[model samples]
Target: MEFINIALSNLPVTPENNQQPSEGMQTGLDLKEKLSEKMKMAVEHDFFAGIYYLQGKYGHTYRELSTSRNLLQQIYREILEYYIDGTWVLLESAAPIILRTQDAKSKHFLQLGFRDLESSRLFHQRGSNIGKKLYTNQINFYKQGIKRVRRARKYGVLAILESRTPVEEKKEYQYVSYDEVRNPSITEDVKEYDRVLNKMIGLISRQLVDATIQSSTRGYPLELDLIEMHQDNFGAIIPDHPHLLNRFLSEVETAKFHERQKLPDRSRPSR
Candidate 1:
């Protein structure tokens, strides 16, 4: 995975080569540590929320899970800022510097938020007598989370692309023109970054489809609403990758067909 590759590439090696960690690397590590701490707190809240949900204490569930979800959203924004800031640094650097650590960290937090929100939605869906307002709110919250994460991923790609500077020109130029020249190494990095984000997006799309199917089976009949909302939010974000959207729609159709097959045949006359 690109995330793993980026993390491995940023590891501080022994001084045999007289190499030292860059400012970007140290900053990335510090930010990651802070974010990790925050995420732990969020997880605890989510756990308590789950317990409250199971105990039929939805009031408590709402308060605790809201806390957790808000924290995750805060972390998501921080990650987005990190990428945006990193892009500026990359654009200003005289030498080529890959801040994959920053990218990796940002992607990690986004993925966590994605999973947490999806799990929460599924958990709430399983409950009896959930109001339409509550269901709509949950779906909207999930959509917003998806949008924030996708934006972070987009900025992460920009940061990677910003780091593509020719080695020969580093000494002469104070600010490398990322667009004028394409470094092969940096090109590879961008490709790897896209590959990883694409995979993540595909996974999330599948999960959304699965969740829609599950909700429908539970009598929510949210297939069209959820699918349309997802396409509008998630699918619209990646205009370059229409295939992912297409595959998601196809899966929804297949799921609907199977679901229809499971229903009792009403065409036969009652005995």
Candidate 2:
């Protein structure tokens, strides 16, 4: 209400600086000021009423916090799909597109001003793990994609291995490619993808095991870590499925040769 009052009070009347104020001008200004104040008060009243309703209806504040998290997840997914396919398929596609649909519902519910808590809750639950992963996977991808776009503005082609971070606080190391990080080849550019991948795998596995051991020593139970272990084990069973590209595996991927699986040396697999 105070915010509303402040905003309303700041409203200005547009009158010529040199013009003298007539009785009619003064009367119109007074009416406008009154109407603006009334409108602000009404808006504030409605806003508080809605909040009160949510407080009464919802289970608790965590439910609302969860909804906010899901909303952010939806936004992340939308932006990710746009980057990956380099097309706004989510912008048009419906039903099967889990994330975009959630985003739409989030927008609609927020626009309607959060009156329908149940609808919003159900909307939040509509999102899936894959949808969440797709969003997470594309963060670095988009950063590289944007850098590529900027370079393309000058160079005719985007340079491979041009996008790289410094190693050990030293810029002296040759720039490593993200492509090499994700899908290394046997060329001089990626002479040792296998060696890198093996080292990364060992490092990640040891870290996870150590973390699990340390957490066990502490009073806090490592439920989430166990769940992650189970998922990783499951993912190993079916490495071909696209769903392995979730946040859980993404960390493993980034820490371990960025999950650069070897392509076949022979003919491409038939569809």
In order, candidate lDDTs are 0.41, 0.31
lDDT of 1 at 249: 26
TM-score list, all predictions: 0.34, 0.17
Runs in model 1 with CA error above 4 Å? 1-20, 92-271
Q: In model 2, where do residues sit more than 4 Å from their true spots?
A: 1-59, 87-157, 160-271
Error of 1 at 231 (Å): 24
Best by TM-score: 1
lDDT for each residue of candidate 2 in 1-271, tens digit (9 for 90 to 100):
2322221222224356667644433433564355443443334333333454565744434443344334334333332222222111111121132233343432432323222222322223343323554433333333333233222211110010111111342234557789877986665554233433343355446552221211121222211122222222121222222221132222322222222224547676568
TM-score of 2: 0.17
lDDT: worst 10-residue window of model 2:
156-165
TM-score of 1: 0.34
Write out the backbone clash pairs for model 2: none
